[model samples]
Target: MIWPLDGASSDVVFNTWSHFSLSLNLEAASFTRYITPTKVEQKVRHLVIEWIRNEIVRHIPDAEVLVFGSTPVDMYLPSGDIDLVVQSKSLAVEGPPRSNITRIADILRSTDMALGEVRIFASAKIPILKFVSRHGKFSIDISVNVSNGVAAASIIRDFIRDIPGVKPLSLIVKCFLRSRDANEVYRGGLSSYLVVCMVIYFFQTHKGMRKSHTDPSSSLGNLLLEFLQLFGYDFNYLQSGISLRDGGKTFSRSERHWIYRPSQPRLCIEDPQNTQLDAGAGIHDIRRIQMLFIHAYDQLQAEIQRRDRSRSKALLLEGNSLLQIIMGVPLNVSATGPRWIAIDKANARKSSIGSILPCSIPQGDSIDY
Candidate 1:
């Protein structure tokens, strides 16, 4: 059973949220390394996306370019990468798609936009073109015809439109995940997409705790606290898998027939569009992730207890107390080792970041999103 937030705990959560949101605009900005992508950063992404699309269409006339993910949805951090999908009838060919994508990457390299090395992952499950912009200070990922990502962006956009506070709550949690170095699922953590889905599931199912008349900001404080509690204490990954489309219900692990691997981290979040795809399949260190969630929860509870007693220490910890703990005091900027190093001589590889080719466009491509 879910733990209900009583009146007292509810007050504490609300007050803490107020302080947390305020601090995000104030004190948290001072110590936190990242910020919500500024207007200038967003404009730079638009220009880059246009440049890529035009170059692709020169070869494939029917090609279309779509920008999805957090950027289009208005929930991205300044450091967040722009996700793009290029689709055209020309890409459906006889051999691997990498050859064609590499050609496109070559074209992009010729342009001034390709400040850093442009990489082509031909062997990736979904072939991708990755590069960091010199002027924009943001990274980009271009995939071939990933219509699913476009669909996801549409659904999330609707969710934000209907649900108040969804944007702010998402920003806060994403910042928290970024701070903990747990947002990239490929690195044994969760993705921003999965986190967004989890927040939606919680909002849909917990009507008792949400008053229709109450502003979303007020509800968000308690919702944030409950979110950590849900993942940290209540959820059972071993026995069940989360199915948001099924009204946030749990289905037995046996029903899913997922092969158990002692070596792999297993926390299943059924993709609403595709049941076979475990949205959380990339999570390899779930225990460590849950520990952080629980710690955050306990820290808030302790602070609330202190506040109730009118303690001197509680007064000292006011203003940005919760925000500081959530975002952490000092950013972790360590370069103790090379960015990527191999253990053995045979596996050794050097940085491949600045390679480029000549790809330019006369005009910008039409954008769908």
Candidate 2:
């Protein structure tokens, strides 16, 4: 429970930011603990990877299956997709051959490893086979001969190691956007990688935060508040673009030759590895996203003020905590452990894949690579 039941209040006074900060810190820590994969879950992931590898190899002996993305970097949310890259001498850099993708899809469909339909997006810029695991515990995206995801994973790992507040902050932001249904790149929202880069940029560019020696863990509340403030109202998305290269800097969009599409108004996050690519290009509703951030910041501030006023009167106010007001409900971990709600289950789109036969790949369905 993120907050006490209605009509309940703490026995102690809550008149300062410290009290609210403490609550935020506790909630962040609790959420992190609940979302971090347990040893058993890790083992299951590994087993699934190995099973896929073995299945692929049985047909294409030279193919290599490699885990990438958040899974490799220990930054994944509970329901996050596992990204796998299949490398083979025969596969093209653009993507795997259609025949190969179809073959792999067939293999996956024949086995019980895949829970629902094995969807092969052969026409996608980077063709992929997407499916849910048989246990319904994981969603997996497999791309062939595409090394970019693997490379991006390595970069994220470096950021996690070198940056002070990358891990926890990223986790929190991921959950925040996910709860709002704005974390999927295919759905005009931000991807997990884009979310991470935004956090890294926040850490690198904020002078007060950069110069402070405060332990990130102890100051998560303040950091999160400031982060919302920065992105919500301060960032000039029309002129400024986020970049992680050269230790992080915000470049002028015009100077970078990145056009500002007023109609779409997407966040511009330059790909550190690929200078020409805009990591946030997929997002079509940047204004709405920023408005969401602003609302979260305002709601948190209001909660703090309300609590302070209530405490001044020696009244115990019962309601959602600061974090809960913004992030909605705290995830409920089932007693059975692995089965848990990664976000608010009521609003989340349930995976359609579930012990069903392979659906025909849509030739016209495609997404940016």
Model 1, 211: alpha-carbon shift in Å? 5.2
Instruction: State each model's CA lDDT, in order.
Output: 0.62, 0.71
RMSD in angstroms between candidate 1 and the native structure over all alpha carbons: 9.7
The lowest-lDDT stretch of 10 consecutive residues in candidate 2 is 346-355
| Candidate 1 residue pairs in clash (backbone atoms < 3 Å) | 107-359, 109-357, 110-357, 110-358, 110-359, 117-353
Query: Top model by TM-score, which number?
Result: 2
lDDT of 1 by residue, 1-369 (tens): 001111111112223333333322333222222234444445555665666667767767877878888979867765678898877667656345787677668767876667779999888888998997654545888887668988888888887787655676677677677778888877766788888887777776677634575665644556667888988888776767777774567677767876376444367778876888777776767888888889877876666565555644445333324444565542221211111110111111111211221244233333456
Candidate 1 Cα errors over 4 Å, as ranges: 1-41, 209-211, 262-265, 311-318, 330-368
Top candidate on lDDT is 2
